[model samples]
Structures are given as C-alpha cells and as structure tokens.
Target: MPLDEPAALAEGSSRLPTLEFALTGSTADYLIHASPDLLSKARAFEHWESTRLAHGLLPFARSLQTPPAAHTTLREQDGRDVRGLNFSSQDYLALSSHPAVVAAAQEAMARFGVHSAGSSVLAGNVGDGVALEQALADFLGLPHVLLFPTGWAAGFGVIKGLVRPDDHVVMDVLAHNCLQTGARAATRHVHLHRHLDVDHARRLLTRIRRNDPHNGIMLITEGCFSMDADSPDLAALQALAQEFQALLVVDVAHDLGAMGPNGQGQIGLQGLHGQIDVVIGAFSKSFASNGGFVAGRSRALKEYLRYFAATATFSNALSPLQIAVIHQSLKIVRSVEGEWRREQLMQAVQALRQALTQEGLTVWGQASPIVPVLLGDERRARLAVREMGQRHLLANLVEFPAVPRHRARLRMQVMSSHTAEDAQQAAATVAAALAASAQLMPQAAQTP
Candidate 1:
C-alpha cells in the first residue's frame, strides 16, 4: 500500500554519494539556518527525488477513492486482461457468487429486511442473527458467540475488553495489523514470538504463569497467517498455554471453513476444542458476508458482552439476508468437506508456487492459500506489480512496515473459484511480469 517507498538499494546505492547527495537545499535556506543532520537528510531525499524523476519511478495512485468513481475491474483496463488470471483478492472459498449462498440470502431478505433499523442494544439484533450466533457457537464448540460489524473491530473489542495495561500479551510474530493494534491499544507489554515459534513463546509465558498467574496474560495467534498462509501448531500452543496457565485466543480469519477436520478450524482440527479460551474470525471471508464474531465460554462471553466495544453494536446488524447467506455458506462449507474445493485450492497454490519458482521469482508460504512473491527491492516490487497489471494479473504489493524494509512483495491469494487453469495462467502472467521487471530494472535485481 506504500507508494513511492524508497528502496535505496533498488535506487542504486553507488548511484549517489552521501555527502554530496545530502547537501541539497529546500525552502529552509541551507545557507545559514539548517542543522548538519537536517541538511544531509534533505539532500539525500532530494537526490532520491532526482533519481525517481530520471527513472520515471514517481507514482500517483489515481485509483484510490470511494467506490462509485473507482474502476470496477482489471478486466476493464485497456490492453489488459484478454485472459490473464487474478492472483490477488481474499475471495477464499469463493462463496460470494455461489448460487446456494445467493438464494439463501435472498430468502432471508424477503423474510426480514435490508437493514436492521437500530443498534443491537436497541432493536437491530434480528432473529436470524440470534440463530446464526447459536450456529456459530455450535460449530466452534464454544458456549457463546457475539457478532461484530468487522474483523478489525471484533479484534479491537476483544483486546480492549480483556487486556488491561497490566496485562502481558504475546502473539505469533507475523500476526496481522488488527491483532497488533488491538494488543497495543489494550496493553503495553506486548511480546511477539518468532513466527510459529511456540517454544520461544513458552519461555516467556513461564514467568507470567508462576508469579502473576491470575494477572491478565493473553496469548494471541492466528489460525492461519493471511500473508504466508501457514497455520499455527494449535495443539502445541494449547499445551504451552495450559502449562503456563495463560489464556489462548486465536483468530481464524483465514482458517475457518478451510481448516480443521470438518472446516471448523485449528481448534477443532487438533481436538483442542474446549481448551482454547477464545476464538475470533471474520464472517466476511468464509461466509462471504459483512461482519465478524468472537466465540468463547459463557463466563468470557458474558464478560465480553458487557465490556466489548464492537462497532456492530452501534451500526445496523448484518441484514437478515446476509445472515442467511452466512448460515447457508457455513452449512455448505461443512457439508462439502470432502469435496474438491479444498483440495483444488491446495493444488492451485502448489501449482502457482511451483510455476513462479521455476520462473525465478522468490515466493514464500506453504499451501494454506496466500502467496507472497518476495521482490526484495521496493521499486522492483512496484514495477513487478505494475507489469503484472500489464499482463492482466491483479495482485497487490506489500512494502515496508506491513513487512520489513526490502522485504516488499506481491501478496497473491488463491480462491476456490479459480480453476487449475486459472492458477496456472495467473502464474504465467506473474512470470511474465517477473521477466519484464528483471529486464526493465536490471540494477534492482543486481543489488544484494
């Protein structure tokens, strides 16, 4: 999402000398008013601007805006998409356009209405929402569940409700921004274990368990990492939690309906059903609806209901139509457990990874669904993404802070709707982009 993110290495290190490059002037009158450090920074950035101008690397994101004005599809872009495939978007399971899901939502809308006139605290909590929450709790094997308007809000509500400043929160290293935001908003002692490093996590939990066992100590992790698409070892982490006497809260945003024995997620997959203290996920992803939820035991749920600050509480509830669609989707996803949707999805990921790997693009992730092409330099990442569009492939770029600097990548998501041929075609488009980007920016790949 970062635009004009400077990649010094991508920009060519030897291309500019520090002292000379750092000596340019701005409106600040470098003749007498500037500190040496400030003058140097200005010059470096000024040199950066000059290099950008020379390479035509400057970008203006005219595509950004509220909906109505936005371009509807990559398909509509000129000289693009005669038949290139999409490697981006979180339409995992691809239930949005499913006929069954569509029909159920229509029926619910007929029975209930487009909008729930008030908040849940008022009269917005519809009958279908009640039933859906019950259905969710049953699937999760939890005693209670609460729905929220969005995954980010649900996460924020959970942490803000449970984690006091005195609390200690530990999470998997690569948790999404939602978890980090929620944790930081709730407490200060936020400790992150290396991605999937439960043993290292256990070491930190040991002290909290013994000395301040009852103090608020929460362990947060994702059921499936969105970017890398790898799953956490829930059974292992659950064991560590019991040993350390800490509460384990997991976000199944990516795993729900795609993981576990019956698509119930890692908690169910590992037989750690009642052991996990809390489970959270977005209804938006799996159900292809517009909300999120938190599930837990009665005690926790009741406490959360009292303290959780979900934006859904103030906003209109999921339209009865959306609730029905979600319920129907969940049921179908469960019933179709042995079907090719899941297998095909895995196959597609493997195929794309293999295809792109052969083409010399650095792809990361296991086959849980997300694929990130590690284009180490930011501008190369940008050029790769732009050329991907030229090849009619729709993918997104990830640059610094969403990832570390120089770890910029194109995060590709796999959807069940994508055919084997679709994935392969997508890979070809990305490969083409890779080759073109390499040729176009030879210096970028040459830097270490």
Candidate 2:
C-alpha cells in the first residue's frame, strides 16, 4: 500500500496525526524485551516500523537512483524519484567518480577479475593487496599495516585480536559503534569517559592502573566523529596511555584523506604523526573504495593480527580491484591534487556551516566535512526530514540511539565537488523545512 501523503502545508495548524503517532515511541523502545519468544520481539518491531512506513516517516534504507554526486536522485518509499542537492554520501574528496580512480579500477578488474576468492591469510593476498598495505603504512607513517574487509572490521579486529579477556578498555563515550562493540567483545572491563574530556579519561586510566596494573589497557578514540564532527585531544590521550603503560588506538575513518595538511588526518594535524600506538582507517570515506586497515609501529604486531584477527583470518580479503582503486586514491591524496581537493572540501564545509548558521540553524562542531544541524525534538526532526524530502533536499536524519533521545539532527556530509551555490541552496531548503515543520505543529502534545 502507498504511504499516506503528508498533510498540506498550513500556518499554525495542529500536529498531523502521522507525525504525532511517530513521536509516541522510538527504536530504543523495542531494543529490549521481557518476552522470551524471539519471534514475538520481531513481530512487535515490525508493527512499529510498518506504522512509520505508512506515515512516510521511515527515512532509513533510501535507494540512490543515480550516482551519489553533489546533485543526485533518490527513490522514495512510494516509488517516486526525488532529485535534490545531495549531502548524504560520504565521498568526502569526491574521488569515487574521478577519471584516474575509475581507470585504475577498470585496469584492476581486467587483470584480476572481481573476487579475491579466499581470506588474506589463504589465497586472497594478491600482489596488489600487499602493495596497497605497504603504501598505506608509508602514508600513515607507521612501519606495518594489516588489511581488513571493512573499517568496522578493522576497528573490531584490532581490539578483539590483541586485547585479552582480562584486559581493560578506556574509550570515549561518543566513539563509533564498531569500536564500542569491539571493546565489549574483547573484555567486560570497558570504561567510557565523557566525550572529548581528557581529564575524565585520565581519571579512568588512573583507576584502572591502580586496580590491575598487570593486565593490558587499550585506549580508543576517533580522529573525527562522523555524527558530531568533533575530535578528542589525541596528544593528551597518548600521554595518558604512556603514563599508564597502555596502548592508544585512534580510528581515522572520517578524516583520513579528507583533512589535514598532507591528508594524514587529525593525527598529523595534532602533530602526533607516526607516534600513535595504533591507527585504524577506512577507505569508503575518501579513498573511493570499501576496505580498512590497522597500522602500527611493530612488524610483529602486524603478523600477529594477520593470524589472530578473526575478521581478517576468517573473512575474505579485499579484492584486487578495491586495492588498486585505494592505491590510486592514496597516490592522489599525497599529491598536490589531493591538497587542492582537501582545500576545496574544507571550503565547502565552511560555506555550508556558515550558510546554515546564517539561516539561524544550530550547527555542531568546528569546520569539517560533516555539518550536523541540531534539531532538539525527535518529532520535530522527523517532520523536518519529511519536509526536506518534499523540498528536494537530501540529507540523513540521525536520532535516538545514535545520539541522545531529544538531540536528533540532520547529518549533512559535504564533498569537494559541492559548489558554494550548493551550500547556499541546502541551507535555504533546510531553513524552509524547519519552518514548515514548526508551522504544521505550533504546539506539541505529550506523546504516550
């Protein structure tokens, strides 16, 4: 059945029935259950999802009808093609469609075909994969690197592979889901410090060292958080780790190849290049490929992770084509062209942030590729997202479990290919959408 059309735009109107109903609950409500029957839980969640879908509020799993360029088309749930200014894709440097990157991929496909056919430890370790690993190690200023199928796997594998069950993990509270899951899988003594609070982390490290100095402690943080577009004090974290004799792991997934002077990401920007204990990165963000790597200072650590990391040992390795594309992207990232792209990307980010601010929207974090517009209420955010879609603006709505319950927002990912006009148009559309959403519901009723 087709979703019901959104209520007509009107000034000072009461809340739409659909919008009011969606505000009643969230995904978190269904995360846990007292029912022992697993099927019962699934059915209950399906019912809630169906209601959201029928009301045109289900924004997840949108299909891209075209390439995820600055301007693209998306297929809505009602089978309608909505063309808009796209800020939802993570192609930070816009290298995905670059001529050189595409040519390299074609050449790799011609030579190696499509599949790796086995795990990296087995038959999957192609010549191209090895070269890419070495190139990444050099780029990161680390002596050794190990490849994984994805960025998430890289984050999860490093912790799960090295940290023992008795070890402790100190992580930022706002760290990515992959890192959080990896810490939990590795040990039960996982401690979360306040976001970007170096002192809070020091206290935790102090407490952990006081209790169990013998067991290992792995400190984890990100170069740039995708949601909030913020970073922690890596130098301070490294100092804490050194004082406590712990290992500092920094995931550079969002910022690598997309920020910093030489595209070395936050580590280089913060003057900690080549000094970090572990540096994890993903290619999907800016490398024009889908893969991940863990770079470290010790060759023995690389060899151990290669054999021990289940995500790398049990899973298939990256294909030759992916390795080739990433290698080519890495080359561009190190060249003057990469610097130009980074400059353009930062310019776009600043333009979007300034435009959003000028339009009276609350922008989060500093100058970065991600521009999160704070929408305090989940109900307002959902309605605003629907309005954005109607106005031909494409962005992702993050809510509930991803962030605090009331702190829902629209995450706009900027790319180097986006022009100044694109930023202005996006900000204008966003402002209009928020206004329309507010007008549709002048007063919000209590949701039960």
The prediction achieving the highest lDDT against the true structure is 2
Note the Cα lDDT for every prediction shown: 0.69, 0.88
User: lDDT, candidate 2, residue 209?
Assistant: 88
Task: Tell me the deviation in Å of residue 241 in model 1.
Answer: 1.8
For candidate 1, lDDT tens digit of each residue in 1-448? 1112223534445644322122112222223333455555455455555544334332222232211110124332122222345555566677777778889988877877677776766688888888898888888888788887778878877877778898899898898888898899888889889999988898778866666756778889998787776777888887777777677889988878865567776667677776678888897666777788888887556445534565655566666777888898888777864245666666777878888787777888676667888877665666666677666666677665568767777888777666667766777777787677766655424453
Tens-place lDDT per residue, model 2, 403-443, is: 99789999999999999999999999999999887776535
Model 2: per-residue Cα lDDT at residue 42: 58
Report the C-alpha displacement of residue 148, candidate 1, in angstroms.
0.9
Candidate 1 has an lDDT of: 0.69
